[model samples]
Target: MAGKFIVIEGLEGAGKTTAINTVARVLNQHQICDLQFTREPGGTPIAEALRNIIKNGLDNEPLTNKAELLMLYAARIQLVENVIKPALKIGKWVIGDRHDLSTQAYQGGGRELDRIFIETLQTQVLGNFKPDLTLYLDISPELGLKRARSRGQLDRIEQQSLAFFERIRQRYLELAERDNTIVTIDAAKSIAEVTAQIETTLNAWLTN
Candidate 1:
């Protein structure tokens, strides 16, 4: 059987790192050890360069919303074609930190970009490529940002207004509602509870 692509997604400080660790542990428990880890907009050298520009502006040049969206696609395609696709072809399970869903949420919803345009870009760049399973750690923007601030200085996107992240979360929930492959977990819970939820959800999906 071909390897599966699993992605973890959420707003900043939504505990995605911890969730990813849990997923790896569960997969290992099932004796599925061959794994390829990736992060977007990164994984490939080109994608990493794009990620830096996306996270931090260059030469104080103002990055427009449209330009930002296009950059994201460029990075995504690089990672997908160069890293993710090859890994899956070789039967290595790929665990991704984020994927196209972030664009749908951030650009389409938060940036208030045209949904039709974003969808068209998705088709052109990614086609049918997507994760087999996406775990969305749902948390309010206030709480999430508060946690994010505790870690260190906020990045460019992270420094956006609370309203921006709220839009992103709303989009995430809306998308997750209609997508059976997406599992939403309440991230406000304790670490132990969150881990249990992820384990339960992933185990059930694996068994099915």
Candidate 2:
């Protein structure tokens, strides 16, 4: 049997990192399956290097929307080829913090980039391997961004304006609406509540 694939998605401060780590531990405790928690932009060596560049903005110039989209795709392709597929083939549960939908949100909505172009790239490059489950942490930009800022020194991508984050949040909701595999959760709740929500969802999935 093919491995189960799970995706955890949300805005900058939707508590994705904490949830992923928590979920990984939960998965292990239940012995549901072998679980791996990883993130986008870099799950491999070369892709990680690319990730640093994208997040840090060492280029120190505004990245065009198209370039931003393509850069994300480039890293995603590397991730799929290098890590995700191989693990899934061996029956490992792969929990991606963010995946292609993120590119669609950040580049497509946040940056007002070309949608058709991105759809074409996704269709052509990432075929058939869809997530078994996608957990959407639904939260507004105002609430999410405030939490994000408190985390630490913001990265270049995180430095984007409130309007940009709003667009991305809207896009995430749009994706959840369109995709049946996604489970949207109320993210404005406390960390423990949000974590509990995620746990409940995963538990339900495992029972099915």
Per-model TM values vs. the true structure: 0.99, 0.94
TM-score for candidate 1, please give it: 0.99
Which lDDT tens digits does candidate 1 get at residues 37-88? 9998888888899999999999999999999999999999988888889889
Q: Candidate 2 — what's its lDDT?
A: 0.84
Task: Tell me the TM-score of model 2.
Answer: 0.94
**Candidate 2: misplaced stretches above 4 Å?**
59-62
| Model 1 regions lying over 4 Å from their true place | none
lDDT per residue (tens digit) for residues 63-83 in model 2: 666766777888888888888
Error of 1 at 178 (Å): 0.6
Please give the RMSD of candidate 1 to the true structure: 0.6
